[model samples]
Target: MSSIANTDEPAAATAQGHGHSASTLTLAVGAVGVVFGDIGTSPLYAFRETFAAHHGAIGITPDAEHIHGVLSLVFWSMMMVVTVKYVLTIMRADNKGEGGSLALLALIRRASDNRRWTAPLILLGVFATALFYGDSMITPAISVLSATEGLQYIVPGFKPWIVPTAVAILFGLFAIQSRGSGKVGKLFGPIMLTYFGMLATLGVMHLSANPAIILETINPINALRFFQADGFTAFIALGSVVLAVTGAEALYADMGHFGRKPIGLSWLTFVFPALMLNYMGQGAMILSASSPAAAAALVKDPFFLMIPDLVRVPVIILALLATIIASQAVISGAFSLTQQAIQLGFIPRMEIRHTSASAAGQIYIPTINWGLMVMVILLVLFFQSSTNLAAAYGIAVTGAMFIDTLLLAAVLFSLWRWPVWKALPLVAAFLIVDVAYFGANLIKVPQGGWVPLLIGFVIFTLLTTWSRGRELMRASMSESALPIEIFAKSAQNSATRVAGTAVFMASTNTGVPSALLHNIKHNKVLHERILILTVAVQDVPYLESIERYSCKDLGNGFYRVTIRCGFLEETDVPALLRTLDLCGAPFDMMHTSFFLSRQTLLASAKPGMAIWREKLFAWMLRNAASAMEFFRLPTNRVVELGSQVEI
Candidate 1:
């Protein structure tokens, strides 16, 4: 604790900047594929759900006024929620070229300089991340089902195979996660480009055929009239309309992967136009129908039905591929967020495998991959259709969006110190939009909206428990810490000095590590050169290599080393050790032995946590992947010393 300083500004990593080596245009293309995938695929179902959500619970007649109004809502929802809040405003609040709830939280934490008020903000960020898991599971389920449902148009018998086909597609999607997103993203970029091209082409064809509604769809007055004419019904319809902008928050979340400019550029210059065009096309196609029956039939599934009969099958196949790409993006995002959670101590350390040598952000976590696969399959099986799963969507996305607004307020007002006049109006607009969407979605609780809320609660509990448990565990561990100076001097005279250098891993730099203490007490031997090492994960995404480690001499062949790395960077202790020439010589694998302390947690009624939560913490501790593996230590040279901690 003494060695660790609460710095207001962290030496953030440049990995993201390094990743920008590709031209911005190239990056924008990649962003089109991955960052916009979730939102891009919304056209497959957003329009259909808007007219006929909850089994016609929000059935609005597709007349000229209503058609223009729904189109207005979809267009403006994208404008306000996606372009205004996220692209123009919130994306500016990046943490060293990274953006997301956690990234934003870390930014605010540093900006606040460890103020107590940031605690609530931290919880909000963690809860938003928790809700992301629900989104991660639902996105794949709904996207796949919606795209595959187009099968019913090709072959009426395809209705029965819809769920099973979705399930199989989902299985294969998750199965391929280990292969990494880099190659897949390159492949996806071109396909998604083609998909968006198709979207714009279809929309333009309809837009020209019925140019009557084109001007009306973009008018704010039309959107307002929908609320005025329909009132509560329009509000209820908002729950479905929000499906149109479902991936708005995720676009901000994924800023780290592609940088803000590329994602923002792709959204504005490409994805946004394509999506709006498609929505307008759907609306124009439905509105200009020859009769009411024809309009209603178009309303059923305008996305596929509007496609020319000849190209419909190819478009369906393309839509399926696009949906798979969408699922991959969400799945990859979960992996990246999990890495941040582990580094920030919100979740226990798990095995994180790097999938690409060039991209540091590209990673794969087996536990998360498998857990998401199981949940998605169950959701597809239970819901049985995209419409049912649609009932469970939007809520999580809205809840997370609202949380981001609160976090953004902190950034605008406190971090950036924007004036009252400037920040107030901006925040108020965000709140009104966020509250409206969140409130509309809340009305869907009984209709399966509870699924995401339940998932968020469970995940929030787990994240908080692990965080609190670690605090208590560290407090308990630190109480018995002996100073390194005292231990080094005393051990020098008492223990027989061995030949090789020994590295003791300590969670806190202030303490003589438990493993070091146990070793001397039992074996009564010490390495000629002893290094007490602490690897600190900073809040930023990357750190400069020159500022990587700090070495302090404790005399008597003793040295203290602290390695500082950004949370988003993977730590390889062995590789880091190779770069350190702490005591007149570079660390060699042949002469180095690594020591690790493994804690056995005892869940006691000790007032620190609830009994059940304590047990959960203990279970998590036991199941957490080993420090040896997480730190990428050589298994052959590592020694594990067990110690018990009661909290």
Candidate 2:
């Protein structure tokens, strides 16, 4: 509200395809590759783990009723969660063509100017983001492990080699991230297309053997009957049933990458049909088994068993490739989320490397990539099998989904202004399903569900600490900040005028920068033409070049310039300055000196945060990337003025 402009108009325009030029078919293909990858690979372990005897929750029998019931549950879960809630509903809530918790938070804040609700909404958004880190780490581990576990179906001896093989594959995946995904990204669409086709073909072959399974699965009565018969056990199965829709968040998270229509079309035309057929076919195969013992064995790895013996090796190879693609989606999403966090002031700025020449969203964060690799390898080594990892999976996803329902309620009530009767019933239905899944996963905490929750808590603490600490630090600095008019008059009377132009970076537009005061007090000199510049990150993804900078003349050879950047765009101060012809003088690199303030934070017995948190925030601030690199300032002509601040 100080220097930040309203991003609603620009964000809405971008969401409407203002910047994108891709054809509907092309974007749809891309969506299938990236947006659908996580959910696409769930067939590997969702059904198997649901009835695993080790869990002792849901028991699998060879009877048609049991098989049909599970199939119906999976089918309807996808329809309600993925198709209805996400694809059709949440996708429509895009913030200027962007999705995910943070983007949605910004949209909600902009929609309602209610100061009382702002902080609580921000906390919800931050926690949702924290849970996403858990999802990101678990996704790659489980996806790769499950895909490689297919080796047990081919050679029994390969059982011993699964973990090692997955580790090697994961290391390779993380290693190639620095080079970016542009080259390999093109192959993703075609490879995933082939993978989906194979899924349909295998399912079709099995469905032919027992055509009646499809009819039984299509009916809603089986799901109702299963719940009624199994009671508590069926409720427990909801945790595992949620696996089928594990990557449902990706649909909304990645809406900015591919448009809404493309994602919806891809799901409706190809991905949805392929997944439904395969799941139903697995049910049919188990139901039509020769005996109960045989069916029990097949359910352990139903996805691999669905293929013919002769072609199992080829299919397994295809599955492995598909899983790699799936892992890539979340890894890329992690990088995008971190960038958003930094721009939104929830985290410290980190080094961001643009990987693609044409695509602005394509970026690589070295710290995040290596950190994820280490965590993923540790998980694979610890869990050893996808079955073990499955226990840790659903909690993060369900937690995030539950939070999403809350945010969507805000969107319905405040943003969309939907009628009370219409919104209440729809939101209530979604909350019932979301709460059921979340509660079932909560039961798994004693077993392995604690992993994600623990990770989320740590991350949530770090995020909130940094955010609050920054606010306190800003307040402390603002208390001593001199008004620009007073500082300008003092400088004009007391300081010696130098030969070149000086740009002092200010945190807020209303105050004279600390660096300028320090330079004048110590050096006793100032440049002939002085400028106070403040860089404000807008709540949008990208800003137009013409709307990038606003200049105000403050009199006496002084000007106040505020540069606005979208979260997704690069913040190069010099480049933006050079393009401003209306700022009186053309920017010259050789004649400019940039002044910056480097604050040495002292964590006092402050009331703003706990002592432990203040220390953590201080450590983070010390290790944050330098402003010169982050703002693309020239190193040769820059001067850093150090100051001590207690917060």
What does candidate 1's lDDT look like per residue over 1-647, in tens digits?
11122233456444332357778898899888888888989999988888885634658898989888999999888999999999999999988888889988888987787677888999999999999999999999999999999988888788889988999999999999999878777798899999999999999989898887778988989999998999988999888899999988888888877788888899999999999999999998887899998998899889998899989899999999999999998999899899888888789889999998977788999999999999999999988988888889999999999999999999988988999999999999999999999999998888889999999999999999988888888888888888889988899999999999999988877879899999999999999889998888877878878888889999998999988878787788889888887666888888899998888888887878898998999889889988888988888999999888888
lDDT of each: 0.88, 0.87
* Backbone clash count, each prediction separately: 3, 1
Report how far off residue 593 is in candidate 1 (Å): 0.6
Cα-based TM-score, every candidate: 0.97, 0.97
What is candidate 2's TM-score against the reference? 0.97
- Model 1 TM-score is 0.97
> All predictions: root-mean-square deviation over Cα?
2.1, 2.2
